[model samples]
Target: MSFTRCSLFSRQSSSDHSPSLLFTGLRWTFGAIALSLGAIAAVNTIITARTPPMGPRLNGLFGRYPARYGDLAYAIGGEGPPIVLVHSLDPGQSSASWRAVFDLLADDFTVYAFDWQGYGLSDPNPEGLNAREFGAQLRDFIRDIVGTKATVIAHGSAAPLVLEAAESGQINGLILVCPDGSAPDEPRQTERAEFLAQKEISDRLLEFPIIGTAVLNWWRSKPNLEREAHEFALWDKSQVENEARLWHVAAHQKGAQRAQKALLKGRFAAPWRELWKNSSTPALLVWGRHARGFESASEWGALRPDASLQVVENALLMPQLDAPQEFAGFVSEWVKKHTE
Candidate 1:
């Protein structure tokens, strides 16, 4: 009706459409939420897919309190006497750390390789990450799982647990490989304390929410894995190329960051030297000639003359991985001599 044009019939400006703007804003917000949820779902799916299967590998869970993250994953194979191969407490390490020597040892004695709690396929417990607890776990594992007094071969920081088990008469024999300690006169105590302090700080930082994930992703990057493999694990770069993928995958497993955080915080470290000194069990100390720490094997030998010392030539920290045949040979002979 042109007779009197109503105000409602007037042309409205773009600014007048507040309701439309609000609707559009709501749609965008919901879209963003959906996209975020989808991304999270995808990531979870990938993690689930990448998780390794236990398979028919004779792996089993053992511990007294299974519900309290006391379930430990272990693999057993071969025949004859039992020999448990315990891996180091280094970041990203697990039962897989002994893969290079597992089959070789399995050829002779019944070999057991296990992931410490929170590492590899084992359960995680933030509160149970300490040396005494770990030592108890080993003792229980031997008593319950192996069903016999088994010989223990422990590496790096894992040395303490075996040593403690030996002290408690839970194990038949003990072997320490590139253990974490220095000679009495060496000025390593202060250095070790400072290093542990830094590691504790780093571990705490890695426990943060988003930042922890980001930092761990960076820490487990391909380049870093390659560097660690060559500089620390292996003498040859070709060996790194072969094992880097396995290490990378192991480092990315669920709870791996938490495990590494627990270890780096020195939770598994104890008065290991005192334990070693007091241990009555027959022990074999296997050292890599080029290993950085424990340079004074001769000095330690003087203190614990009962323990035998053997240095693997041309090997760094991991003689088992670098020179599996020789390491296995030494182990076989030592086990035979001691077990007899």
Candidate 2:
């Protein structure tokens, strides 16, 4: 999924960029801006939802299949060894998160990307599919439809699933982009402990009514939501669509909300120290320099002889979106080298 800042309102203005003023009033200003932006986005979504569908036909890219979670939808294309791309649980991104890379690679490889249940066009998963459950579905997807061991690529929250799937011998190759739950080199034990504790607290906060409404509103608010939708479509001015915006609105739908809640509760993390200690799949770890997590890509690389890490300068969370051509070139060359 793409990265977009949450908006909130504040009394401060952008003109107050003075270092001293920022030092003294940064917190309040940031909060206010966030609030205002969030409110704007939420209102825009409400209005947009009420209007008729305004974008071009999405075409017949969606396919339906039944899984334990209910009906699931996917879009497949391209022409090489099957590559299954899994977008993260990031709030607003769906298959479009891989749009840039998808278009570029589809010319060379058979690309299969899907909307995870409760996230996009796919049916909701009330039980909230965790990595374990996701891995089971992945096994079925590869063995049944792809018809061969495929290369698995994931961004953000799905890294754990890709890792677990590879370790379990479900796939032959793995790629993790801006993965969450990553630890930095020389990580302070306190940081790790705090992360563990904060995850639970954050989950709970998102579930609370007043705070949750504020958070969701902020997430859906105007310039913020617009930017989020734009980012998912790779910030390309031409690619922006009403459906992308609608997807953002649909994200707050009952089913999607349940999935969001489930995600914050640690449905994606798995203790994998031992698993990494003896894995054989070749992995390529790509992270954005601006991404908060995954600071120690090199350290992770050191853990596995075949794992390589590439840090894309200035890319926030979705490097594929942030630097499409570069990522496409890398993926093209990488798959060629590793896929035999």
Candidate 3:
């Protein structure tokens, strides 16, 4: 009886201790995870602080104007009818998107290209910027700098901003390449939060601070950029090796995450369908046949009977980079037709 009692007491003691041990283990596990994240953030912050800027510069920086919101940087050269090129908005996109078309159009028309606020050469916007702010910047550029009617060309998500800014007679001609119509056309409201939860994990990570900057740097790393350029936007990724290198430089600029955070937060995209449909400005719409997530040219074309649509066979999202000569030709011919 004494031996059995001793054995039962021992069993009860171990059972009592097991819960405490498990609770201790859980605390240690959570503590380790928190420590690891903090260490990673600290390392990344140091690396970011030490890293110097990089570039394959856009050649000419026409000016930097202090606007009401963020500062501006634009390049201008060649002389004729004014033409403005607005680069697509991606996490790290800059005016580098226009290297080919900018030079080509410069020969026949005075060409302008700008780094959007929070991107290359332009002042970074740390408070975060949205399309409404971007539209204001573009409008001021047209009203103050261009100082006259001009033809505006925009790529991808930059279209809505341009479309909204091209107030009656401010832009006589508009050319949009692969403009995003994926957002709902039901309401014209921008700055919507409807798309926030739908973003990918990588994009959502861009909203955080040190960790976000680290994630943006990783995304902008040369190899990942090459893969993104290869698989989605560019038809000839090998040809844009220099552009990819330049883009890597632009993407790593300090405070680049501000606009990117806005981009991922659904601030840069909205339903441009009705806005696009309502525009009276003479327009040319182009799409790459291989583009992954956009509607067919025919679908977008149905909205505007007066507009011309072309689906280029050997291009993807960025025909400007892929087929510069051909894209410039399209613009040149179309503008001439409108001018004549």
Candidate 4:
């Protein structure tokens, strides 16, 4: 009887402790992984910073301009009401996204497109890109560089930055292509705080050094870039055929991971739809005809009855890239209406 009681008690105690032991084991395992990645990330970043970049450095249509985070690479052309083209987010993309339509629009408007810091042709910042800083940069660019209130055409992740930049009041109008979300009129501060908190933890880990950078390089690798292009970015894969190879070069630049790390930390994100809704500035929302599972322009119209929405034919993810002429026409007409 005594032995039986002792055995039963021992079994119960072991069972009770197993779950906590498992959790501790998992925490240690992840900690080891974090350390490994951090070491590798630091080495990679240092090597990149020390050496000159290899093969075909990124170039802008015009040249670099003095901007907040670093010297921003920009291109300006044409002779009418000024328009600024802000590229999609991430280290992989830059003003190059506008190449297809830039010249077309330049015919009528003084079109300007530039690489934000930590991106193509722009100097890399060790601290990485932050959404608010980008917003402030855009604001300054418009005030000092652009020199006038103009139409801002932004795509994908860049849309939110545009909204941020618009807060300072240099914007006469906006065109958001395939914007990320429909923001609520009221700020969802609680949800944002929680989300940011979660990301901050990860961001801290990524800010370490080598391992984090390695992970980012893995993500920005050519294969991954191609995969994203086919799976989500482009509705038509052929458009990527003649694409510039500079992004591959750009991704490996020293401190490239800083931008990726900041992005992962959620520093570059914003409530774009909400910002657009509240801006009271004249605005247009555009979508690719085949924008896979996104809110339809009509659905968006119903949500913001005051706003205008348009759909370009035979495009997805990137309406302006796939259908530049149609996208250009939208810009020309909208600017005409708002400015006239």
Q: Which is better, 1 or 4, measured by TM-score?
A: 4
Better of 3 and 4 by lDDT: 3
Task: Write the residue-wise lDDT of candidate 3 on 1-340 in tens digits.
Answer: 3455544245656548766666887899999978977987887776567656845445554677677776788888788998888887776688778877877888899888887888877888756466667877887887788888888899888988887787546888999898875554443346345443345565656656657766666766778877777788888867667656666667767877677667756677655776778888899988898987556577678988899887777899999877889998989989878742
User: Which tens-of-lDDT digit does each residue in 1-340 have in candidate 2?
Assistant: 9765333224445565455555657878889977976775676466446634212112325676677767666778767888888888766556666766887878788888877777666777766567778766666777767789888888877776666777656687788887665422333786988776776688778776556656665665545666764653333444446535755655665456667666656676665544564778887888877666655565567777678778787576667877889998888788878864
Pairs with steric clashes in candidate 3: none
Ranking by lDDT: 3, 1, 4, 2
lDDT of each: 0.74, 0.68, 0.76, 0.73
Residues 1-340, model 1: lDDT tens digits: 4575444434445569656666887999999977875765566456547756432223333323242355777787778899999988766677877877888888889888877787766877565467777887788878777888889999887887677667667787989898875322333776988766776678777666555665666676667878877887676456887667666667777677777666655566677678777777888999888877657677567768999998998787788888989999999999989973
Worst 10 residues of 3 by lDDT: 183-192
- Winner of 1 and 4 under lDDT: 1
Error of 1 at 109 (Å): 1.5
Model 3 scores a TM of 0.83
Cα displacement (angstroms), candidate 4, residue 127, comes to 2.2
Query: Using Cα atoms with residue i matched to residue i, what is each candidate's TM-score against the true structure?
Result: 0.75, 0.70, 0.83, 0.77
Q: 1 or 2: which has the higher lDDT? A: 1
Model 1, position 250: C-alpha lDDT score = 70
Off by over 4 Å in 2: 1-60, 182-215, 219-247
